[model samples]
Target: MSVPVPKGFSELTNLRSLSGFPVHVDMDASNSWCSLQELEPLSQLRDLTLYGIEKVQDSRMAEKAMISSKRHLQYLKLNYSASGHTIGTCGAEAEQQQQQSVTEEILEKLCPPTCLESFILRGGYVGRRLPDWMCAPESADFKSLRYLMMENLPCCTQLPDGLCCLPSLEGLTIKDAPAIKRIGPQFQASSSVAARGSTASTSAPFPKLRNLQLIGLCEWEEWEWNDCEEHMDVETAIAMPCLERLQIKNCKLSCLPPGLASTKRHTLRELYLYELTNLTHVENIPSVVKLDVFDCPELKKLTALDSRLQKIRIVCCTKLEVLEGVPALDSLVLEDPTMDTLPEYLQAVNPRYLKLDCNKKLYESSSSPGSSEWDKISHIGKRDINCIEDSDTSSDGYSEED
Candidate 1:
């Protein structure tokens, strides 16, 4: 059997399955034949990924093609810089100008794309604000959208207000967006939205949201509900009732959001904070079953965690001096400890499985295995560990430091 290559996609009126169509668009110069306007021919496409678009002008044509195919599109990923499009690294003003042009083109061509469950915009000149139609529940055709990721958009500033309307939205990630200093306006507990309408509606809360990740945000100063008020209280804001996991990396956040405590320690099950350099506070890690903090050199303590915390892994915090409050934890992993000995209180936690490696203190303690209280509930060991510092280790029982 021979696989026949159609002379050019141009002659085909209806190609049934164009797997990996625009994602790796057969941009082999001579082979590039799918007209940008006639993508509807691939009517069965459930997933469409576009990658490495070099020229900025090509994106305008591609945007139109995406909108046209939205009806059958379940997953859409637009990656603009495999050719290393320099629009992102250029000065903010130049990037802004390009985004404005791109935004208008996308907006004009966009008609509520339906059936989309996940939409991702990666490495391109995205405008400061996403179009209103994209955010509006009434306007968007994607009723089942569960994941939305926007990465490396240098010009984007805020999330759309219609975020609350996404009934199925489970995960929202904003990464490498240097200009986005805040997560929400009306969504925050304290905002002007409360004054104009029901405060309850503004804080409708992420009923299905399980994971929230913010990374590489340099200008982000604070994440508090009712930031406009003189004080933000955790007790007032609605909680993330279903949130189970949280991961923050390389973001210069001063501390955890103040309203997280208001969640009443009800839903949070796993927490990972890494490379947060200026982080000085760790007040509320509620009912967390697993916690991994890595490469946070300035952290002075791991504070306010509940007794139910089951697993704790800490690495390379040169200044970490205390782990006094965590209790009822089943597993304790300490690697590359900053101090010569484990914190005095850590020896007393009730973890059933304990692993220690590479730290001179834990290594010394390994010889005198029965000397500490941790020996009662845990199996302590001294071993050489090898793993990447930034990789996620939650599933295999390991996490990277920073």
Candidate 2:
């Protein structure tokens, strides 16, 4: 249910927090039901959210809100109503261009205060480029911003390059953005850093960022980092110096970025990959202590030379062949009902504890003392294997047959 604000709601000038303030407009009427001008006097706001931003008639009206003037403001969220527009169904090209222009202008005028610590942009933003404040030179305006999330962007083709330069940013998430196809070197360093011809004095990109996630970017296929020798010296440039966790899901990327694996090899601790249909290999991440892989059918090799790696979990990765280079592995878990035999990697890597969720045929072979499957896992200190019976009424299409 939508609640209506009273006629003089802005009269309370002392309010410090506000959320989900809807912008209501009547296209046929001479006057809008609610206008952003109402917020001009509410200068004490410390946190705010504006919903239905797509209904704002023009950039001038948004400028009246004076969001940047609220020095006390620390959090902001701007949400666009879902537009239900996809690639070919957005009507004529001219109309699309007009819509994009209006959206871009409105966002530019709604820049947040410099003290803002967290910001979120949600729904179907159709702009080809992000707001100017989100780009380089202007991005320095957000020196206090600590976190940012952009979701359900239907048309933006690339991430903001300025994000890599944020001095205080710690977490970032970009989800359900289908139009982003590639992440170039610009995403790792600002263009100004490149203009100087050396990174000797330039601070590392993402200096404080610790957690990053990329999900549901189905069209993404490439990430170029180490290949950008013309932009910066790859050997000398440092990035993501404090990163601890990274997750990639439902993307088409064929491999992890070489620069990321090389630069973050000492700071990155956990890696997670899921439903990456085109990914073929994961290798050389020497700092990851935990690795989880699921539903990546095309993955063929996973090699981490890190002595710190202690745990691994793999599920339904049908084509995986080699798993090597973890000398201190403590536990391994494998779950795949379709697999008829133990993976060949088990013969090369010896984990202290092994857990298997397999079908009846595999359990039968492994239970026999003299069988090859039994010989392979007999060296492990502890083992737990669950065999499921083939059946139509089971929860996973198989019932436990203990």
Candidate 3:
């Protein structure tokens, strides 16, 4: 929520932080609330958050805020309130187009300072394209930025192409963006380099990025990175060299991007996939040490060759058939109350510790010596088999009883 500020608020020139500053405009000049122009004098602010940016009448009003000149500011958030707007209604098409244009113009003038390290964009942004400063050539302005998050972008169809060129970015999160159906090659390399057919470049995309999370992108179905090789040497070009952890939830992608498994094969260590209904296989990511998969009923194959993998947890993946190629696995956890017997893949890999949650009948059989179920898992050094009623399980299949 935004708090109304007095028109004279700018008099506090020594203020170091300001949050929830409201930007509200009235038709009558004398009746307007505090305007963006008032923020021009608060140059000492290090943390700032501006709400209702969509209310600014024009780009000039946004420019008056002089946000780019605040060299000391390190954290900034720009919010666009979608409270009163409704999509797909009568006469809404033309009105939405006009709003999108105005919102784009307003954001262009609200660019943050170059020294800013963290930035967030919240609420519904109506603009079809991000501001110019967030794209090519101009993107170099964010040389010091380390983290960025965009939440609830309902209308954006694509991600900013220049994000791959951010040299200092370490963490990125994009959530609840339903309109994005695919991530194209432009998101893996600079568009300028791809357009010029450059044989070599000094830096790779996402050179320092370490953690990435994508959630609630229900419509996303494809990720394209192989095409980037057409413009650069496949053997020499590298992307996401420093990435270590990746988590994806509620997406429709059938397979992980080829470039990710091929390029990040040595650095990526942890991977988590949840509710990816269309995915069928997980393979070739030899660097991953910990893997978790939940509620992916269609997944049929899981393979990694000569990996450093140590721990694996799988829950509710009913169709899984093959699990192989992890030569150094140490622990394995499986939870499913419906299974009547042990899965065939248990004999393929050898884990020192094995844990299972199953129906009472299977649990009792596995606990008895010389039984078929017990013989199948007898090779494991340590085993803990429990009936469903004896263990407490979370929605994602992880048992709290462990």
Candidate 4:
């Protein structure tokens, strides 16, 4: 559409920065764009946001705009919102095919220069798959790609195959891909070994990936550890050598992937798992210093907590019956209303802070003068129950602050 610039805004012909150019097609013949052709003159544009991509016309004029030719562009966000006429409508199969074709062509032709440092795909992409160029060929190595985030892509069954091949990539997030039932070999950096710019001696899929977030994957039940059965030998497995922090939220998986659960295999130091109803256990990641579990109803036990763990938070886990072997634990937070009692082992260890944030039933028992719960938790230096606290801070938790 005609994004009316501030009368003379276009006159800043030498401007190095321009932002917020919304593109949308009015379904009713009432409104129309002046064509994406006008953007060709903005030679100095370095950042762009293209919204309402699904609304573009079928003639593919927008594709011919050749966005990738903008050599100086460093950042871009592509937003797509499905139109009224989609796969769910009558005679859907044919209409869906046509739409997918148009979407793929539009994405394929809108290539960004290799200088792009950040890319974001926001909103819904009903197309079942993404265009190939989302992850450029290995020849380019995507040296400047530092961050990538894709969300609301419910119809896409798999992530871009070459996504992690970028040697410079440091952060990644994938959200709300409900149709993705499994994470297969395509996700591992070693799957594209030769293209990783590394010798056959070593392959790092996410060489620089330090932080990762996976959220709202409703149907993802498995993180396939052995996708390439022919090469399933331990030697060919890929590890997250650089990943230090990871978070998984609202997923349908019943267990943690072997890579993220083993400290010997991954470099993860911080982990958070939330709302995973099917998960039954948490264990084996000894490198993690901080661990948090929230709203996971099926998780019944925490086995082999790392000796390096300094802080732990467990909330809303109704069936959690045990926490084993955490000698280095410095702080413990049991905020779940379902926990009627503290673990008996917690009475001996001393920590700087012990927060018991349960409902009135447990909180009252801890507050009663001669109660067993109150006596057991007395060793903790500082105590806060439902926001009320004892000011006696513990030297154990204080000196070991992370």
Candidate 5:
């Protein structure tokens, strides 16, 4: 796996971008691997990416690379390719430990400069643990990072600590990280230390985050704060206190981070859920203005829909029968709704616009003059039943039902 860097790479002193370097250590003492230290001369690098990091075994050499010297760099991506390796046997396990130890040291040395604004780590790291440098709230100026993405690290049991809490992070996306089961205060410990006992109120994690997405986490079950060892009281905890939008898709998580979930009461404005079959109940969301649920066949009810929730679009949620909290909704859009019966309080929602994306017979019984649904929706000024079209797009289909 030891690949030598081109002999003249260092001579490219003015390189503005460099990527796909494969530096490695060989089993023979006679063989030589290119040292990462060669990159220090590329001072003008604005974007740098390192691929095949698992092959680099000389931790000291990596440490001397001085990646932090590139003050002009704004974007960095690190890749580790462990493609055909298997960790099934004793010998393989030992080798992983050795590789990871050196990898961790190299990563520690390759910390990006404070001016870095975007970072991505795409890997299939099967090592027992990730490098310590991945953890955020580092002594380094990691607060300058605005956009963060971690993808394809399927065996990574936990995400980097406090990643969501970065003071300047505006967009965060985590995909294909199957091992992450929870994201709570435990992950934010490193950054929370300074605020531990101070009574002075501080900004919460995800304070400036506007968009947060979690996808393809197969083992995720809960995001409950009561399950963690955090010292903050839930009633006062302002986690994700400034979040504007959140999306959870293709995950097995039946629940959300309690701290993040609590923010729905006042901070969260929009929520989108898709293909989360195990997610059956959603309650206590009092402030969400736009809520969209799709293809979650197991979801039987919205246990508590906020009274002021302005709009809701439900698609293919076959088991959902109740929408208890939406007593004052302004618009209701349904497509492939499986509920055989509607909530008794349907009249209370009093939606001015009701659009049903079905075969027009959806409310056959209720469409009649004396039916309860007729009485329930008769007050709606705008109602329409359009044939279902695309599943991914919205269907306003607002026709005046005279």
Candidate 6:
């Protein structure tokens, strides 16, 4: 449906969340951007997921102006677009002077800034660094931010140290930051550096942060944990003691750092490793409750699991075949390349859930495609495998940020 008229949109003042914008990758003619533009009048709006990047390009000027002008918003999800690199004027040379002036004026006029709770810039060109004011609590900008997720920002090279030190930040997910060679002080300060970087040592700790996920960072060769010790005094670098969940994906590291061993184990519950080609072993994740490994071909075996581990999932590991230790598990998911049969010990657990998919090349003796696996799992009151795949893979053209 087309968007309601700009003035008429205010009639729906009670609106809180809007999702499922049309993001058809192929279709280009649909111009329902006005409907999205109409969303600005939603004064109580707290959550938004704009998934139609192809459509957003048509009315970016209007949308950016509305978002920059509107206040009281807590959550915002802008559609992904490589072209969304900059938020101001583009090719219109004639109207550029007037438009730029108005945009700056509006941004300034939007005083004191709203207490944004969660801001996710997904699948866009976030331009290698966050805006200087993004995480500044003293500036009262994002004073309420709790979760921040930026995905597929190919050009983003580094995150400001100030961004990491946000007082209210709880969960952070940075995906597909191919150019981001390092984080915080390991990377040089660009013009995006705010206040010469925080004096707070990396070891000084982030009292509130609970979850962190770093994925698809091709150039992220190393996480400079050692550098933190040199730059930050011993007293300040030991801070992020509350971290509970850590997931690293598609990185180049062959092994985790010595400092990370058991340091946060008292609070950490889950650990995930995905497609880290150089990673040959999984170690130091003590007290972890759940272990998930996917596409790590170099990993050949499962090490001793902590007493607290409830589940372990290994998927598509061609070279890795054996799993040891951990007598009981709540669940196990094995998606492998080749297997002649299920590991004999795997059946002993009687797990609440178990998934074996696309292992025909690995296991020639297991039940065929639609066999006892589905029957066993379905009778346990769990979702059917086909249904689960459909639910996850369907292009609903929308996503939600936490």
Write down the lDDT of every candidate, Cα atoms only.
0.59, 0.80, 0.81, 0.70, 0.68, 0.56
Which digits, one per residue and each the tens of the lDDT, describe model 5 over residues 1-402? Answer: 535675557779889987777655455545444556678688999988887766566667676667887889999997867573334556576776676565556667677887889988777555544555455445224668888887777566776665644678888888887777776555544345433343455455555677888888767776645323255465324556567788998877675555544533376789999889788877766578899998887887785666678899987887776776776678898777344444454565667788766533444645566776567767777787554344523533335566
Q: Of the pair 1 and 4, which is ahead by lDDT?
A: 4
* Backbone clash numbers for all candidates listed: 3, 0, 0, 3, 1, 17
Indicate the worst ten consecutive residues by lDDT in candidate 6: 393-402
Decide which is better by TM-score, 2 or 6: 2
For all predicted structures, in order, the TM-scores are 0.74, 0.89, 0.89, 0.84, 0.77, 0.60
Candidate 5: residue 138 lDDT (0-100)? 55
- Model 1 / residue 204 / CA error / Å: 2.5
Candidate 2 lDDT, tens digit per residue, 1-402? 345454476787999999999776554434535567678889999999988888785898899889999999999998887853333344578877877888889899999988999999997777888987887767766789999999888888998888886779999999988889999888887434732233445567777889999999989999987734345554335677788899999999989987766633477889999999999999877689899999999999997657789899998898999999988999998888788888888888888888887787887787777899877787777777777554321322222222
Q: How well does candidate 6 match the true structure in TM-score terms?
A: 0.60
lDDT score at residue 148, model 3, on the 0-100 scale? 94
Please list the residue runs of candidate 4 whose C-alpha ends up more than 4 Å from where it truly belongs after superposition: 1-13, 24-33, 82-87, 135-140, 191-201, 226-238, 262-267, 343-350, 387-402
Which pairs of residues collide in model 2? none
Residue ranges of candidate 6 with Cα displaced over 4 Å: 1-71, 83-114, 135-141, 184-204, 226-239, 301-305, 321-333, 340-402
Residue 144 in model 6: lDDT? 71
User: Which stretches of model 5 miss by more than 4 angstroms?
Assistant: 1-6, 19-37, 81-92, 95-105, 136-140, 188-203, 226-237, 261-265, 337-348, 359-378, 388-400
| lDDT, residue 284, model 4 | 72
Q: Rank the candidates by TM-score, best first.
A: 2, 3, 4, 5, 1, 6
Better of 4 and 5 by lDDT: 4
Between candidates 1 and 2, the lDDT winner: 2
Output the lDDT of residue 375, model 6. Answer: 30
